[model samples]
Target: MVEVDNATLIAFTVLALLAFVVALIFTGLSVAKKSKLFVNTIGEVSAKYETDITPATYAFGIWNLIFIWQAAWLLYAFGSIWRYADGGPVLMKPDILPIEFYLFWISCCLLYIGWLFLWDREYLFYAFIDLFLLTGCGYAAVAYQSIALNNNMIGLMSKSPVDVTLVYVLVQNGTDLFFSWTTVATLLNLASALANDPLLKRNLSAKSASTISLVILGIMVLSWSLIENTVWFDYFKYVYAWYAVLLWALIAVIVKNYDRTNYNSVFSIVLLCLVVIALVVKVAVYASRIS
Candidate 1:
């Protein structure tokens, strides 16, 4: 039997608490703002595509209900972790695989769910799985985002263009921004997860956060450029890349100055400038090509 030290146990408890808080905040904000956008966008897309699927047809209303349930479950999981730390029985089996493994599995499930949407046929049963997959992935992402931001290992592994491109391909072909955004959201979540971990509390420095944020921001910029060049005329592609870049940039600024009051104002200005330049150049080139 492996003996877990008191310090290690305490650290895990703190980490769980932090993850719970962060997840709660994110979900609350998402539900408040993004959920409306999601419904509206889906309605618009269906209309544009001339699809018969209505918000009701695709169970959008029910999805919000499921999301609330999932958020409750996540809170319960975190509470269980905290309870187990104080000499209680394990709330969840430590025998369960590492968080990253769970994240990967959730990602695969999300991909599957998105694929189901590609068919003209509606599978109402699959909607349950889709909701489950989103909840799982969102939870895992939040739990791990902090950790990855602090550790730098997960983001490093995700550095390769080929690897990132593969993820992008899956997202594109899946034809669902929900899956793509969730994947990206998880990357951010990993950072949040590590931020609250006890072991990493001391080891996770401001510099590390800044570096991780910068790297992710760079990836977002590169991805935006690629999408702009490849699908310049597609409004959807532009919107996707533009919003993704903005989100990553916001994250970078937040992480880069995690401990500072002044924050990365200079970097934020530079990033905005660059984005404008990139957009202008891409648009000009696209127009020239069309002419």
Candidate 2:
């Protein structure tokens, strides 16, 4: 309901898009700066603290897909802006979007950059809070989109599903995809933090470490089950790729670290079984969605 004139909207949109580019650059820098030898240069820096929930480095290659889609969305937005200069009445509509949308979106972008810095610095607790804020703003955008989906600006209104516009495809669907992955990313990152906090690893006994990991896994599965029955049930499918990535990470850890000389095979086996079951559920849900 916040009306934005053509000139103001164009300026704001361009600025926010630039901010996203900057944040992405910083993230890419962090990735590039990671320790080639040991990978301890970045945050969460300890081999011993790694957990089954942490995805292998290659799993993050999904960023390529995310980046391409984001670039396409930005290009489409610029095209919409150009329409206003063609004597079109600012092309003012939900598709072009109001000021409030940009505000929430820019906040998400900013929070992500901040979150990255905190995460890279190994501030696990603060990074968790940052992820909460980042994801909260993202979900807020989703809520706004749901309301505006049926609004007259886009004018598909109640017929959104059947007669979707390009705006719906790029803007609306883009938001959904970004949010879906971030939701999973946040949880996986959080679980990794819990399992690999350096201080805890130094202080806790071997048995305690295994016990804590199991507790964390149990809580995550319980949380997943609760969400499964809710309106957000689709979240499970969104998380499937992450579970698959984690499976790979777990398998790698077992290959490299699971030995009687250093680790408990019984605990490792139990851990593997738990994650495998979770991955199976995630795969099943994802497949069902495709079907």
Predicted model with the maximum lDDT: 2
> What TM-score does structure 1 among the candidates reach?
0.34
Which number leads on TM-score?
2
What TM-score goes with each of the models?
0.34, 0.63
What would the per-residue lDDT of candidate 2 be over residues 108-166, giving only the tens digit for each residue?
88988787777766766577678878878876775565455445443443323332455
Off by over 4 Å in 1: 1-180, 199-202, 226-241, 244-263
For the record, the alpha-carbon RMSD of candidate 2 to the native fold, in angstroms, is 6.5
Q: Lowest-lDDT window of 10 residues in candidate 2?
A: 35-44
Cα lDDT listed for each candidate = 0.40, 0.59
* Span of ten consecutive residues with least summed lDDT in model 1: 49-58
Writing each residue's lDDT as its tens digit, candidate 1 over 1-291 gives 233554454455455445435544544443353554223333343233221101123333433533444444344434444444224423223311134523443454444335234211222224334544664564444334323322433342334224223322332222223334444333333333333234343534433443454456557666857755775334323234344434443544444333333334445455666667776777676678777
> Clash totals for all models, in order?
12, 0
